[model samples]
Every structure is written in C-alpha cells, then in structure tokens.
Target: MAYTPELSNDQSRTLRRIAWALNMPMTKAMNAVFEYAGNIIDKKRVCAACKDNSKCNTCAFNQKRWSGSPHDHQKNKELCLLSLIKK
Candidate 1:
C-alpha cells in the first residue's frame, strides 16, 4: 500500500506544489521540508505590560515564529511584559 501523508488541505496543497516545483515526489518533498522541529514560548505574563492590554484579553492567541531558528523561542515583542522588565 502506498502511504499518503496526513496533512491539512492547505498543507497538502502547498506541499504538493512545492514537490512539483522541485520535480520530486510529494513524500520526498515532505521529508525534505519537515526535517526539523520548532518551539513555542509562553508569553502570557507579558500581556501585563502591553499597551494593547484590552485587545490581549480577548485575543485567541496562536504562536508565530519569533526567531528565524525554529528551535529557539523568545517573547512576543509587541505584547510581552518581559520587554518592559528587560528595559
């Protein structure tokens, strides 16, 4: 049996497109693209010092890449209280 990757619709499409662009099979593209890991940092306390305190309270927060290196995690710059503490 051939294995199909479990990816979201968007993810599948993107990966397939990438594979086609690279002239590689979808599975090979998936392997080449996903040979790494990432980290998420909690900046919940950082919200305390945010000027956007009002928006932060209701924000359905999700993680974005804070650093170029996916393994390293840092505070959310715009909303993290740690920035205030660091100054």
Candidate 2:
C-alpha cells in the first residue's frame, strides 16, 4: 500500500508558490499553513474571558472541537477564516 498527497489545482499552485517563497518542501509549507490557520482559529474560538487555562476538559469551546463531524469542523473552520477576512 502507498499513500499520496492530493490537492486541488489552485491549492497545488498556491502551495508550490509558498514552498518556493520559503525555500522549503511542500510538506513543510503545508504544515506551516496548518499551524497558521490553527492559530487563527484558536485565537478566535477560544474563550477570552476565562481565567482558567488548564480546564480544557470541561470547557464548552474545547469540548465542541471533539464532538463535530469532520465536515462540520471543516465548514466551521472555513467560516471562521472567512469571517476574519470580512471584518
């Protein structure tokens, strides 16, 4: 068995450009993208008023991250990013 990475045409081109700009491999470029996006999502979605930082197990926002279907998570992530762009 073998595994292969796949991307849409636009995604592939964008990733290649990122890789070129960073002088890094595609995998690293993709990982960088994921980290950047996750930071945006976390900063936006995590509770801002909570003083307890170690209570993720009981936090509603953290709990929701584990409960959704993958499609739902992806849609929510896209919506979150889009909302940031629209602001």
What would the TM-scores of all predictions be? 0.35, 0.44
Weakest lDDT window of 10 consecutive positions for candidate 2: 76-85
TM-score for predicted model 1 compared with the true structure: 0.35
- Cα displacement (Å) at residue 12, model 2: 0.3
For model 1, residues 1-87, the per-residue Cα lDDT tens digits are 277657899988988886776577887766545432112234454444456545543332313323254433323321221222234
| lDDT, candidates in the order shown | 0.47, 0.58
Cα lDDT of model 2 by residue, 1-85, tens digit: 2776679999999989877766678787776566445444553345775677786664444645546542355443322223223
**Error at 67, model 2, angstroms:** 22
Model 1, residue 77: C-alpha shift (Å): 37
- RMSD per model, one decimal: 14.8, 12.5
Q: Model 2: what TM-score? A: 0.44
